[model samples]
Target: MAVNIQKGLAAAGLAPLHVWNRTASKAEPVQAEGAIVEPSLESLASKCSLIFAMTFDDAALESAFSAISALSNKSKETENKILVTCSTVAPSLVQQLEHKTKSVSVLSAPVFGRPDAAAAKMLVAVLAGGSETEKNLVAKYLEYTTRKITRLGGPAHTANVLKLTGNFCILSVIEMLAQAQTLAEKNGVPREAVVDVVSALMPGPIVTGYSERIARDEFDVGFTVDGGLKDVGLMRDLASSSSVSLPFADIAHGHLERQKAENKDLDWASLAKIVRKDSHL
Candidate 1:
């Protein structure tokens, strides 16, 4: 994802990109692509006016923010710095970060796309920030990274809420596809035939791509089961906090847990396998 973001930026003529990753060697390739690899998070934060972070979870985000906060304090240039967090963390955590940090302008811009979509620069970015200026500032750079940027025009964390909800919807679609495909196969219908019917009806990349993968039993980890579980868990927590019920989330969560219990390293679309197993197909 980081590599694609950098590549997109470079393609858009945004040069001298600076990047840092926990695994330094992983960033070496990005450096070879003209991005300057920073030795540490603090160095990256200090050097870049606009910094984007795409960490795995809240802990990683907090760690990155800590380094950015330190840089803000040390440099006394908080007003000039903008921190754009692209990680799909809980909205509450983003709210907490905004509340805790008064220096740099923090924006939530979680993206929607697979790595391939990102590589193609077709990612959709959901953006929210403290102000229009802040949002616009980040949007300038994001324009290069994503195909579309939708501004929520509210607090920074609102973008996180939208992102989580959007993820839940995607998971719901995956579950539906899983169950539907399983039903088709069990009823003496070919999986490809089912996919062909759905492809005509759905006519989108996600449906077509995932359906093909599920039909071919090609669960090559576009998104891991663990990652899907994490997002579903986040959705469940958020839903609970808001007194909303998500039965499908629970079902997806259960499927992921079962898959994890079996110690299977599988893609998220492998949720179809749960239904396939249940149907004895």
Candidate 2:
């Protein structure tokens, strides 16, 4: 995200010269590239036009907010502050985050795309907030960094809902690919052959990538196995809250759990590995 912002900032001549992270050492690379490293999250929050929390889950989101809340309590005067959350979390939790940040304007602005896409300034930022003023301000701020910007409803959760929905679709595709590869490998057909056929007919990059991962067992460091499990877990929770029976989600959730139990460090795409291995591929 920092890299993405850097590229966008340079393009817009709004270069970010100051930044911070949970791991102070992680901020070194950016600092080396002409960005000032802030002493603390509080200091960082006070300095920036907008502070983005691109954390993993609801728990992480709450922890960041806890820090911000502590800081807000210390200062009597508050200026133009916006907490742009770029994390994939439940909408309800985002509302809680918004309510918790008393002085700062909270906006749900989850972004789509991986680190590489972000580095290229091609991320899709989805913005949603009750405050149109804040939302518009965030949209403009995001425009300085991302290629595409989507504005959602008049609530902070809208962007999070969109992000979760998109993740569900991605998980669905991965689950299907896993089963398909399992079926293909069980028969005389090779997984690659099946993938090639599917790629030619369907032609989605995600499916194509997962197909290769399943075939070659190449679930690496990108999007780890634990993360996949967490996402599937979130999908199940969301489906349950909506009173929807998603059998496929259940199966996917189980697959993720099994993968975690076996090889916790595997990449998320490695969910396909579980199905393939179970079928003796």
Candidate 3:
């Protein structure tokens, strides 16, 4: 994802990027693509005015923010720096980060898309910041990395909330597709035939692409079951805090947990197998 983001940025004439990764070997590919590899997070933070931290979870996001904050405390030049967090995290985490760092502007810009979509520069970016100026400044650079940008306004956490909810919707759709396909297959209908009918009715990438994958049993890791479980857990927490209930989320969570128990490394699409197994297919 980082490589694709850098490639898109370079394609949009935003080259000469300073790249760094915790694993030095992983940064090699980005360096080969013409990005100047930085030795450390502190070095990258010191040199770049606009830094993007795309980590796996909130814990990693907090560590990245800590490095940036330490640099900000030591250098006056860091005041105007912009920190764009592209990781999927809870809205409350973003709020806490904002409160902790008053020097640099924090823009919560969680993205939506699989790796292929990101490589094609077709990812949808949901952005929120403290001001329009900050958002515009970040969006101008991010345009190269995404097909469309949805600005959610001044509150930084709004974009995080949107990301979590949007992911929940995707998981719900996956669960629906899994069960529907299972039902069709058990009734002497071919999985492909069922997917074809749904594709004709729905006609969207999510439906067409994922349904086809489920039909083919192509559960390669675009997004892992564990990753889906993490996001769904976050959604459940968000709903609980707001005195709301997401029954579908609970269902999806259970399916993902079952999938994880059986095969710990399969993609989230493997949730389809739960339906198939339940039907004794």
Candidate 4:
């Protein structure tokens, strides 16, 4: 995802892109696209006016932010630096970041897309928090990497909550596809036939894509069940706080639990396996 973001920015004529990953080897690939791999987060923070973090989860984001925050304290250069997080995190954490990082602008840009969509620059971004100027600066470079950007305005946590809810919706669709395919196969019909029928009716990416993914057993890579669980947990928390109920999320949560036990290595779309198992297929 980082490499593709850098590649898109470079293609847009954004120059001297700087990238740093906890694992230096993981960042080496971006260098091929003309980005300089920095030795430390501090070094990267020092060089760039805006720093974008695409962390895996809360802990990863915290670690990355701490490094940048520390650098901001010691150097005058990063005082006005904008910290844009593209991670899906709890809304509370986003608020905390806004509170703690007085010197830096914290903008939440939680994205929606699988790795394939990311590589294709088809990701949808939701931007929240920071001044209008700050957001425009962040969006300028981000526009190169995303299909569309939605600005939610102020209280960066709004973007994080929305990101969690978006993940819940995607997970719910995956669960629906899983159950639908299971029923089709149990009736002695092929899952591909079900996929074709759905494609003709609705013809959207999440449905068509997962239907194909489930039918072909191409669940070896991409978003993991563990990753899905983290996002689901966040969404559930959001639902609870807002006094709203998400029954599909509850259902998906149960399937994900089974997924963790049996199909942990497969891509999260393999939540379909649980439906198949329930039918004793």
Candidate 5:
């Protein structure tokens, strides 16, 4: 994701790109696109005016923040830095980071897209936090990487909450597609028949893509069952806190758990296997 973001930036004729990754080798690809791969965190912090982090989870995001905070704001660049995080973490974590990063402005700029979308610069970005000038700076660059940028214009954590909510809706569609395809197969109907109906009705890339994945039995790539379980847990916890009922998520959780127990590394679309078993297919 970081590599592609830089590619978009470079392609759009943006200024000299600076990047730092935990793994030195992983940052090399972007160097071909005119990005300077910094060796240490301090070098990155000192050089970049707007730093965008693409950490995987809360622990990783917090660890990166801690390392930067330990830097003691030595550089003048650090004193006037904008930290825009694109991690899919809890809103509370974003809120905490805002309070903790006394000098730097933190923006919750989570995005909705798979790796393919990111590579193609078609990501949907949701941004919040910072003053109008700060957000505009981040969003201005984000325009190169994302198809649309929705500035929520509130507490920095608002974007994180909305990101999780959007993720839940996406997972719901995958879970539903898995069930629908399995049902069609069990009823002596060709899976393609159901796929055809879904394509004609929904017409969105996600709906059509997953429907075809199910029909083609292509469940070996992309998001795994373990990943689905993690998102499911996040959504369930969010729903519980809000006194909302997500019965479908409860059902998908059970299916994902069963798949995880089998120790099979399958894509999320393979959750249909559990549904197939229940129907005795």
Candidate 6:
């Protein structure tokens, strides 16, 4: 993730690409690759006209913005500065960030891709914010980072909403794969064989890519088990708040929780392995 941000910054030709990480040493690799390391988030936020953040969740985002808020008044008072947040957070929380940094324009710009996709600059970005001038500034900056940009709605966390909804679709596929592969393995069919059949039928990136991992129990933490659980929890909360019932989401959330209970170190794909082992497959 740090590498992707560095690559994007280099590609965008941004000067003094300052970065701050939770751990000091973690930013070393990016620093070695020509990114300037900021000692604190406040320093980073104060110097830039545009600040782009990609943290883990709402709490982290809020913490970063809180630091930014502490320094907001020290900078120029105009709305010339912009914050392009690329984290997958709750819409309501994003609204809070915007309200806190009232002088800074906030743009919700969440990305979709694995680490490799991000490094290759092939990630799809979803942008949602008002201020056409701000959007253009952001788009110009991101042209070197992503293959495409999708603009949704203004003054709303539309990008985060879309990103979460997109994850639900992936979660559905994961649940189906877990159940179907478990059935196949129990029936004495080779997991690889089952994967091949599904791959041929689906012929899409998600199916083809995850099928091999499920066959080989390759649930490494590019996306971790804990993270999947977090998303499922958030999705369920969103559904409940909107008065919608999501049964499949309920099942997926259960699988994630089960994996977390034991072998909590496994990746998101560990949910499939849980079903496989449970079914004696």
Off by over 4 Å in 1: 4-13
Clash pairs for candidate 2: none
217-272 per-residue lDDT for model 3 (tens digits): 99985888888888988899899999998999998888889999988578898988
Q: In order, what lDDT does every prediction score? A: 0.85, 0.76, 0.86, 0.86, 0.82, 0.79
Ranking of models by lDDT: 3, 4, 1, 5, 6, 2
TM-score of each: 0.94, 0.90, 0.95, 0.94, 0.93, 0.91
Query: Residue 153 of candidate 1: its Cα lDDT?
Result: 73
Clashing pairs in 1: none
Clashes of each: 0, 0, 0, 0, 0, 0
Give lDDT tens digits, candidate 5, residues 152-251.
Answer: 9688989988988888777778789877887888788898999999999999888898889878878889888887887788778878988999898898
C-alpha lDDT of residue 118 in model 5: 79
Query: Candidate 2's residue-wise lDDT over 1-281, tens digit each?
Result: 67556655666787765787877898887776667789987787667657778786888888777767666667665454677888888777887767765576788888877777767667788888857877776787677557898887767887887887787887888889888878877887888898899899889567787777767878776777788777777777777888988788788777888888878888877777677677776
Pairing residues by index, what is the TM-score of model 6?
Answer: 0.91
Compose the digit string of candidate 1's lDDT tens values, residues 211-280: 8898998987688888888899899999999999899999989988887766456898888877778888
**What value does the lDDT take at residue 147 in candidate 3?**
91
What tens-digit string does per-residue lDDT give for candidate 4 at 129-194? 998988888888777668999999668889998888788878888898889888989899999999
Please, what are the lDDT tens digits per residue for candidate 6 over residues 123-176?
788888858877887777666558888887567477887888988888888888
